[model samples]
Target: MENDREGPVPQNGSEGPVPRVGVAVFLLRGKTVLLGKRRSSLGDSTFALPGGHLEFGESFEDCAAREVKEETGLEIDKMEFLTVTNNPFLDEPKPSHYVVIFIRALLRDPQQVPQNLEPNKCDGWDWYDWNNLPNPLFWPLENMVQSGFNPFPID
Candidate 1:
């Protein structure tokens, strides 16, 4: 096989790479939602919801619950389908694409504060007002905000 690809070899021995699915969570407490400042991985230094890549053969809800616990050390409940996003990492040296699924969840116990369980992946977790989110949100989250996706349910 004559390889003329400019970047790294595609996975699974395919000629083209496939887009991955990402799962991001929205953990709300009243008007505030939990967000973590990313420290490593794709969107380092940007704030993102507490979730990660969807595992093979796992349901979206399952991935959401698992990711939140793995990253924030807090159990979430009452999950609701939020929204979806298509993100492309064009600026990166390596080409990457992701379709992110956003899930809205509530803390199993409202009083249970979040902890940064994966210190290498996140700086810390904090609750912030939806309208007053911190600057430099992750690409998927920024896309969600731009589309006016609110975590609060319409009453």
Candidate 2:
């Protein structure tokens, strides 16, 4: 028997292997969505939604707002929880499990623009037509697509 070091073992002294909670924000601008090119070690160079890990005792909306501001320098409102995806990245060298909370949100102001606040973590942000997304999407995003999750409202 061997223990897989998917990620740093928990320091809490529990059984270990705790799943991390990630909040994926979908900033919808009409028929388009906002995406950023990840520069982080996990999803390097892949296009992903604007979101990050859910902090201790923080509500989903709070996490969404914070991550959006931190990642894209944009404020968001009217957050509606779209769906949840369980992503297990066990095949990668640094494997881990993530319970991703997909949140569909809108810009607080229509004219507010996004900036590369964390240039080291991500490239600049861009508006993308949901139907015409760029290739090599991040794992959770790909999971959403594969599950046929649509951010748009049904007409």
Candidate 3:
């Protein structure tokens, strides 16, 4: 196997592959959702849901909480799994990944405007109605937005 930082994975366990788990959060308010642009060396410069790779031993819910905080500087509670995607575009080496949990969360007291916390992870943030999100976003994210699905149960 070559030094594949973000490569596809072999079918069997014989390959020493990388195991990565990414968690994304869809923050919603009155049908408008928050979106961000990927920065640094991961993902394209296109728009994307706010979330990132999970740290070792971190639960999907925890990762969602942490990432939302780290990237948006907004405290969120009541996270729920919206969907999971096998996203390989994050890295090149190893079998893409096992899971990418998409979480739908409610932002507590959302700031009047968007702010960037992880300068290297995202350049800026913006709010838009889920139906009117910007185009040219990461494919997976666009699918999530277009689906209009919410994993969180409603009363």
Best TM-score among the predictions, by candidate number: 2
How many residue pairs clash per model? 0, 0, 8
Candidate 3, which ten residues in sequence have the lowest lDDT sum?
A: 1-10
**Residue-wise C-alpha lDDT for candidate 1, range 1-155, written one tens digit per residue:** 00001223367889886777778788889999888887755677888888777778998899888888887778889999877777777676667777778888898989787887877677888999999999899777887789887889889
The CA root-mean-square deviation of candidate 3, after full C-alpha superposition on the true structure, stands at: 5.2
Alpha-carbon local distance difference test for all models = 0.77, 0.80, 0.66
Worst 10 residues of 2 by lDDT: 1-10
Q: Write the residue-wise lDDT of candidate 2 on 18-82 in tens digits.
A: 78888888899999999888876677788988888887899989999998988778999899998
- What pairs collide in candidate 1? none
Worst 10 residues of 1 by lDDT: 1-10
lDDT of 3: 0.66
TM-score (C-alpha) between model 1 and the true structure: 0.89
Model 3 lDDT tens row, 1-155: 00112444454665655555677777777677788777533455778778767767888888887777777778887787766776555443223553577888887775545578766666688887765667777667766556776543576
Winner by lDDT between candidate 3 and candidate 1: 1
The candidate scoring highest on lDDT is 2
Error of 3 at 120 (Å): 2.2
